[model samples]
Target: MERRSNKADKFKYLQPVDRAAIALMLVLIVLIGLLIWNGDRTAPRVRNFSWQNQQVGAEDTSFTLNFNRPMDHASVEANLQIDPLLPGKFSWAGRRMAYTLTAPVFYGTNYKVQLQGAKDKSKTESGKENEKLIDPFYGQFSTRDRAFVYIGVEPQEKGRLILYNVTQQKKTVLTPADMAVNDFKIYPEGRKILFSAADWLSQKPGVFEQQLYTVTTGINPLSPGKPETKPEAAGKINLVLDSKNFQNMKFDLSPDGQAIIVQRVNRNKPGEFGLWVIKPGAPPQPLENQPGGDFLITADSGAVAVAQGQGIAILPMTPKAKPLDFLAQYAKVFSFSKDGASAAMLKFNTNYTRSLFLVTNQGVQKELFKTTGSILDAQFDPRSDTLYCLITRLQKGEQDQDQEQPLLATVDLKKAKMTPILALPNQRDIQMSLSQDGLALLFDQLVTEKKLPKTGALTTNDGQAIVNSLLWLLPITPPTEGSKTQQQQPQQLPLPGFRPSWLP
Candidate 1:
């Protein structure tokens, strides 16, 4: 009787405590379940952004956004806004979203991107209670300044490569007094420049003693509008190819800065002329055994286009490699698109006229327009749908004298439409360069005289005695309705230089 009573008392106390613990556990479980089910009501946030206070370039065509939670693609795109109205396409990959620009961004510009009023994936899919909006996101970015380098025509800084900042009034001399810079090409990154130079004090001809070199531009495109902070690496020159055994004629730096294509003629044997390629830290290698005319390296740096026997041969960059493609109708390639998919080429027809053709790598050749005068140069816009050509047309002036007038024209590749942007009367042998953003054009107007017999004076690239040279900046704008000419006027820069080229 005593044992039964003790066991009953213990069971009675344990049963009450066990019931209380079970009830508490059930309450906790229910609370956790409710929290888990309502988690979709939490606000969505942008975890990371690609262009947050970053400096971008033409190569940076796309940006991405990583979200903390899955987002509704349609709502996010509809809520996103970019300043200056950059046109692009959007793509989604799980929690990440990307925006790819259809055209290149403008240089020396400040941009802002904003996003708001977007919903989470769960709230968007299901009509659930307590729906929440995503947190507002904002981003900022800037581009590099508009800058160029040219040969100084002034007597004090003659034969020197000078860098002039168009955005900021800053100038830096890039060559020493002993070296005379001839021609130069900027690297794609704008960090270095490849140029040809000669000893200024040597009694021999500058052409015979020409050597190849690279100089640091000391430009930091990342920090736009601040030339004062970017002052390092100026006037730092390195020898690339020496002219001890051969004479270097025409040379081109690859767009990727990996290879250099140069035309050379052997010193000992005048008949031996060919093309040579120099890689990074490697010796010069012969590309072909014969000579070519007006050669240029492709944008991809995989091949070179050479004008050969009334045709253009696209030869691979390797040694002794055969031609990759050949076009028998075009005489020369003026410039290539940024993607390396299209090119602006020149064709010399038998009817005493030249035609500008838009040639694609897919073997599509469309003639943009035909001109009866000479085609000086051509450049493709960033969109690859417009071509800017510098050509000449015959005009009668002053007692019916035939004059070659230079005209700056833009051709729409899709519509085959030609519009005359600017006409330079009494201008001959002019040089032009297009800006990276396709917003402006740089050209030089030179006043020249006949060269003296044997004077140690300065002369332009075309052997003209340069009296004065002016640099003009023309803003590229569309023609107004019912008007045939652009209303924007050309602004003359306060720099005295010739053969001006924008830093890439």
Candidate 2:
């Protein structure tokens, strides 16, 4: 009875303040529960991020990412940043997002990405706001090692194949001083190099007695104070094809390193020049009805493109693949896209002018540029859309033609615009080399006999200019390049060399 009376008195005499306090406590609990629910809805998390393909040679075209909650499309686009700052577009399907690189990513570079200004767009059951700001997300990836090889152009460094480190700014000559290397190509592994060299053992060789040979590009040419213990043994040079039977003059190694295509000139018949495909330890097979000059094997190794009598033709690796006629009117197929889908070609427009066109795989040709300049060389950018060329425009003179300046320009296929990247005067014997990554280019300037310096770094006392190649590098996509408000010139490497090529 007493406990009942106390309980009854506690409820009976309870002030309005007590009742209000109980109501406030209930409301607080409800508010706290609502806050937790809102947090769960607002929190956005990255579920997965990955590359779609692993066979990307130079640069990947696109990538994908997924999140736990729907994202604000505008916010994601505004906040996303790709290191090396590649231009790209973003698309979203539900919680997953895809990014397509507008300009293909540069090869041999590390890319870091961050998504800072993203927000979640989730729904709440109570019809309340479920918006939440996400934490910054980060990821990083690399394309491949940036590597290149160059032919020594100076007198002392003549005919030497040198492996250069683009990042480290160091160099190591890969060939021996005894042999003279004429033309070379790096295998896909970047460790082995296939080259044609003068055969010293030949009985009575021609002017350029070149034979097929390969050497290890990974060997360290220098040792600690002492000479390489066994220089010959350490040098992994193997005789693939000897020059005894045929004059193996020019050659190109396939990207897969499975076979080599050599433009052979028969020693017996002075006029007989043929194309042969040779494999290690296997007899060389001749391609019938194929007359070759400046030939290149396709990226897939399924066909070969040769500059024949009239035009360039794509002859299949097997006869049944059928021949594809390309550039029927052009004299040469200067360069092919990385995937062999497009080509850069040059045709004579008039006696003094040339027309450069970008030809697609489907026989579609687009006139990139037509100018009165002599197109010394033209190449397709790795992306298969842009084109770069080294053009020398004649300012005056009928025969010699006092040139105004050598112009290095890039043609944007999308906009049909020509932008000059460089302008230099009096650069002779210019040859351009683009890295497999398509991030850099190399060329050499000719040092003529009369203009030779007294120091004679690459000159003879007789005032004859035989060896004059000054190597220069122009970085199109440096991994850590800063903003460019003005034009930048290519840096000249102190080492005198030329005919540079990037390794895949």
Candidate 3:
């Protein structure tokens, strides 16, 4: 039998170059093993922070922290700290930790985050704990400035969209001169404004001929204080829906800024009133449901709440879709929370009294309070536990509609307490808006005149006649324990405008 060559005898015939190459490969494997072992024993560090030096928006509800090594979830969560007290939940995936906010952060606030004593999840080969502490990390972020948009009532800027930067003390006109803006809604990003306008120079400049258009706000959401640079000029105008066959009525811009919900009536058939959606790159389409009164596009931008007969109907935006849910108790839906969890609504009682209710998605209807006067509008604070309402209270011994005084009130949802903030006597058809940070309130007070202006009669969004309008800003301060409720006063903004609204 032939003698079999042993493994050592076969390798003895190898060249010197090949033997050296094998030795180099063995050394590389040992080096790699040593490197991995050292890496596991080293201290963990934050490799990336999602909101590092970034400016966030309302839609930015969560941030992420990436680590260089696997980390102990409990230790990381316990050591994570955010300044100014932002309530949120922590989640982990491998070495990444995510913090999701329970609610939108207050606008115009600078937030700081720090993590010092987080431990890693590494272990020794013998199954012994060998966790390493994470390196100290600090990060910061900021929100956009406090800003608002209004319809300029001044003679030179009449019927124009005016953007006022409350933080910077700057004002800029966003619309052209020849077009008369009817009504407008700003996009959630604050980069564009959707409005209805008509040719003011034309003799037939009527509301029936109004057309939907969008104009550039030039307010960059990323770098808020800096103007947006683009190929098109700032304040560029683009026509969206025209009033060729249907007249555009009250309209709302979707929170995502992808679509517009506008009430329109057929030009030929005045009785045919319905809601139409004008989406970008698509023609206007009508919802298959019946025409309803005073509608609002929901926060999710997927449905709409319309005031139908004796109740409010929540209908999906899709054509031919059935109603998502019909709230037979609520007669009017005013506003929804940022997360779309709660809505401020109105219920009409048989005794002619209207009750404001905080309707939640969790099948809970909380009755805030009842008022004999009408509830013009209500807005939920970013915190969702506070509500600001613009309501009318019947004056003593007066039942006339004009005798109703507008009162700005705040309701603490948790404590079930209602506080009157401001009393606007002789202010009719007044409009109020709450800031994103829940720190300021804006409302317009119109000054009536015996005679109309020489240019023409200026009217509000509600079609009320007015000579001039005054914008007022009221700062909202949290009530402290043992502190008296002092009457808060609003400061006039020196802006001659109506329908003042805070930018998103």
Candidate 4:
């Protein structure tokens, strides 16, 4: 006991520098303890904050942003901002904030929304603040494309009906503006476009009615003051067969380019329209006499399929073979298969209920799924045997007389099912034409109001003002599956005009 007491006393007599060093070590330990206590008492860190349910062209809109923990509603709403900054008219549903845009967006316009000063509600006792979270979100929705086909409208001017490539970002006007264009078709080799145009001898009315014109793919348009190089202009489009009203007149060039099958209207008599096989440079020849309406040429060998009132018939390419009765009494043909072995037809019951059908060999027919509304038009992809159709449905408060919104759907024969290709909400009057490869779709989406109650009463507004008709190319192969559905988005091609007919 005496020796221990002596040792403790000796340590107490240590130097001032040693005492100071011990004091410093004790202070450092206390500081470390304080930091650990502060960290433990703080709130959980917030992370993975993001938005959801975001789309460009949707009418009903909602957004969902996540937080590390349940957030204070006022704080979250205060941080959310949409620009052209929207006014305070939104409602919050739990963690989601929803609001309808008061103003309709213009076509081809881009929009943005910003979130600022977003943070967790939890705070430290020392009054220190956490890192403020912030981000900006952007999206673009385009207005409906225009309808380029001048159906039911007369071409008044003698200028070239230049079919510009509107699908490209850099606008390339493809057709030359030398002569007036009548009904024209792109050549089987897409390099050359074949159209009928008329040279206007005078500025008199009806002088520029019909003319034949052709322009190669890469030909340059003649500029002012440049030497006038006469582009190869074919002669007038001679009236092969004239009709009183050429409603729904359709024409298809054969694969060999030797003949064109046309749905010609015989104006001299009622119900006189019929299918005619005509040589482009030679005289016209008549095919099987059928009620002339819409017709499609087979993708494989140019066999003609004509749609009558209630049924469809396929005229064989061989001169000796008789026309094959392919469809049933209830089915009508709209499109043909690649090999012309099958056709997409609409099946109707006695009650006028309609369903889609794919007619095949062995007299087999499969019904496409029942649609939500009436199916207006259907097209078959000769390459893939896929059927594309346009469906229309009336909106709320829209009567049977009102124009309906059009939707596009694609039917996969392998799956024996249908999938919606596009849901056009703003579109009023819609018309679509598909390319041969099944990759491109030319559509005229009308935004103007259509004349209703056609009792021959002449009530008129500003004539059908076209918005913008665009051609979009969508890939059909590699069917979209699972999470790869994003690849199904249509690739827009630059086209001068909307209606694009693929070459053979």
Model 2 lDDT per residue over 226-247, tens place: 2343334324788888877677
lDDT of 1 by residue, 150-210 (tens): 8777777777899987777789999886677778989875888899988765413344577
Clashes of each: 0, 0, 0, 23
Error of 2 at 202 (Å): 7.0
Between candidates 3 and 4, the TM-score winner: 3
**Local accuracy of candidate 4 as per-residue lDDT tens digits, 235-328:** 2223343332442245666654566666555444536656666665765555645453556666564576666666666676443446666554
Candidate 3: tens digits of C-alpha lDDT, residues 1-504: 233566666689899999999999999999899977655556899999988877777778889999998889999899999988778898888888889987677777899999998888887877777868889999999888788999887789877889998778889898887877777888876878888888764313144677888888776655423344553345889889888888788898778898888898888899988888878788789886888888888989989999999788998887878899988878888999888998999999999999999889998899998988888898987754778888888876545433678888888887767787778857667888888766778998887665433333466544555677889988876444566334567999889988888988
Cα-based lDDT for every prediction: 0.82, 0.69, 0.81, 0.50
Compared with the true structure, model 3 gives a TM-score of 0.88
**What ranking of all candidate models by lDDT puts the best one first?**
1, 3, 2, 4
Candidate 1: list runs displaced more than 4 Å: 1-32, 124-130, 202-206, 222-231, 396-401, 425-427, 453-455, 478-486
lDDT of 3: 0.81
Model 2: lDDT of residue 450? 59
Q: Which candidate tops lDDT?
A: 1
Which should have the higher TM-score, number 1 or number 3?
A: 3
Residue runs of model 3 more than 4 Å from their true location after superposition: 1-16, 32-39, 81-85, 125-128, 201-207, 223-233, 396-402, 450-455, 478-488
